[model samples]
Target: MRTTPTAHPNTELLVYGIREIVDVANKIKGLDPALELTWENIGDPVAKGWSVPQFLKEILTEEIHRADNRSFAYTHSRGNIETRKWAVTYAKQFCPSSTLDYEDILFTNGLGSGIAMLYQMVAPGKRILQPSPTYPTHASFESFCSGNAPIFYKLDPEKGWAPDIADIEAQLQNHPDIVGITVINPNNPTGTIYSQETLEAITRLAEKYNVMIISDEIYFRMVFPGHTHVHMAELAHARVPLIVLRGLSKDIPWPGGRCGWLEFHNTDLDPAFKDYCEAVKKRVLLEVCASTLPQMVIPTVYNHPQFNAWNQQYSTELQTVADSIADTLNQIPELTVNKTLGAFYLMPRFKQGSLNNRQTLPITNPQVKAYIEQAVATPNLADDKRFTYYILANTGIVCVPASDFFSPYPGFRLTTLSRNPEERKKTYERFAEATKAYLGSG
Candidate 1:
């Protein structure tokens, strides 16, 4: 039947940046499954051969039996009240000045859900201000909710991927409609840690502009030595309204838990923010509350005495990995790798004028070369993404284009999550070789 297609105005088929690029890469793929492929694209630590300690695994096992049928039952819409109280006590350890209580905490499926809830609260035509080179999930959610793309302030790559205070001030001063600012400490894709001074400046800006602060501190405890993660709630001090989102996925060393929560700060200082908090809780009820079993494990998992010990040990080793990658990639001459100070990712930026539109990586296989040629024929993909596709085909190395973080930075993010020391060194060496060869081709 040659009937006209029906219109669906209210529907959306949404895709975030990472998956979207990976899809394009897959569509143009020409390689066979002849070799093991390395995934440097996704940020799952456990997937890369990192394992939780035996003691932690036992905690889970014991909790399941001890929790009884309650663990299997649905929790309150705001999550198990007892768990909420425990999370507040835990979060308060970092921000002792915080007055947040059980009522101020709300659980979500993950930090991602918490983000979606917050974005949905943005009034029509109003939006949140995000840092450039942001994690795509947050960026896409803000875009989806506002019906308009959010504006990004600069995170200066020249300055160790630090937030540009002047740029932030200019953005706030220029755009009065920006209701809040979002920051990811131990920033993804770049792994740059924000200094206490930098954080304070941001806090002062939020307070001065009378805007809310939305912080994603998912990597709070993943910091290396000489650097510490500060809770925005610590600096905020109830002066400026704030909401800090964190999760068990990273620190609990458990990604599949699907457990994360938000802590509201200084909401009573602003009537609108207070209302927003109430709205977020009601919104979670719409989802019938995040999965219950993971909520059951939080109090037990966090309060364990040795939790901080192993975590610090892990952090120290992670610092070693970061330094190794920075030193290796920095030696490439064609690359400038940022020394990762917190998270387990490293962003090696291409030196100025290192890549051009017509540049490409070598593809010995004619079919693969043709596939990439076709994929990059138009000005559709970012230059770094084109490099990603070529690198995938040529070396079986998968990585995300760093500029995809939306900072105009020419690079890609690689992780230090590889558990084997020998394999980690070889991987970075191969990466360096590929990058140098790729840049040399231009």
Candidate 2:
């Protein structure tokens, strides 16, 4: 039975539409089971062959054996004391300038939750500036809470997706209501790690603008050998306040663990910002605590030497995978590929004029082709999303549309985390074929 809606949704809160993309793919799957579907749309390392390390699994299993009634008890709403302590030590080791105390940290189910709670703390009429092609979770929440489209400083794709300090300055100069700035290190879709120079420049901009910084360093520890991951907390001078968000989702490849934490840095430097952090904690307090078992896993892992070695090994493997995917995608002349340095994803943009409303792929599967033709014909659909649907129905490969990230461009973001190396290569190679065919540029 269906009921008519009595209340209207805040339409402003509807920008994160990746799930619709997934739904479209599933529909295509039913139309053609012969095609193998490769879901590269989102960042889920565990699904891509980056598995829980055997050593960590062993540790988790042993902990389960020792579990008691106390293990199931609710932890502190902010975080378990021991896990927050470990986070303090971890933050200090990497972020040299990070002088985080236990009280400075608060844990959430994952970085997504952390971002939500933080955004809810922002006052109405105030804004948080983010990067275009941002991780949708960050962009959407900030926008949804403020009931406005996200305001962003550009990450110019031409200059290898680096932040244009001049543009950032202009945004701050023009928008007095923007009270905070976001930095996604070793960024999500683009995979461009901000150099130390860029990090320092941004921190200075925040200080000059009197805006706090929100640095999502979820991929901090995953940068390649030559690229350095700077924790904004480390480089954010004491004058500028920041909230550093991190988690084991990428580092430990434990997305299901849903464990992430926030380190409120230099909060004392701005009493108003300190109040905001307290308010976020108060809201989280109602939920009691984040998932507890994952918190327990961390302290135990820290004691094992294999854990450290495992991280380094996993990072090196990702570097190899990222390079391979970039190399493959760049081979297609119609696409502009950026080699990701830190995270396990890369974005490829269609060269200007390569994709337009008139475009159609040579999808021989009649049902698939018909579905796509109907999809692209719909009014107001993003061209990139239409392209993504064609890619899905034609090639059984799914990549997120760039517009989903609030970008002012047409492209798609794909991951290098396919479980099998050979299959991963084949997936992109097939995509290359499908792309070349779709654009008629081969």
Off by over 4 Å in 1: 1-15, 21-30
Candidate 1 per-residue C-alpha lDDT over 1-442 given as tens digits, one digit per residue, 9 for 90 to 100: 6988875432241336566656655644525545346777777778888778777888778767873677778889888999998888897788888889799899999888888888887777777998988887777778777766668888887888889999899999889988899999989878998888888999999989989999999888899888878778889987889999888886657888878899888878999889878888777788887888889888877778888888899888888877887888889876777798887888787877887777777777677678778877866667887788778777777788876777577788877787788987888788778877888887
For residues 1-442, write the lDDT of model 2, one tens digit per residue.
9988774355556566556678888888888778788888777787766677887888778766774844567888999998899888887887666667899899998878888999988989999999987888888888888888789999999888888899999999999999999998889878899888898999999989899999888887787877777667778858788888888687777789898889888877888898988898888887789988888887777667887788788888888888888898899887898888887878889888888777667777788788888888999988888778878887888888888888787888887777678897789888888888778832
C-alpha RMSD for every candidate? 2.4, 2.4
Where in model 2 is the C-alpha error above 4 Å?
1-9
Q: Which ten residues in a row have the lowest lDDT in candidate 1?
A: 7-16
| Best prediction by TM-score | 2
> Candidate 1: lDDT over CA atoms?
0.81
Q: For each candidate in the order shown, give its overall lDDT on alpha carbons.
A: 0.81, 0.83
Q: What's the C-alpha lDDT at position 397 in model 1? A: 78
What residue pairs clash in candidate 2, if any at all? 48-417, 49-419, 109-258
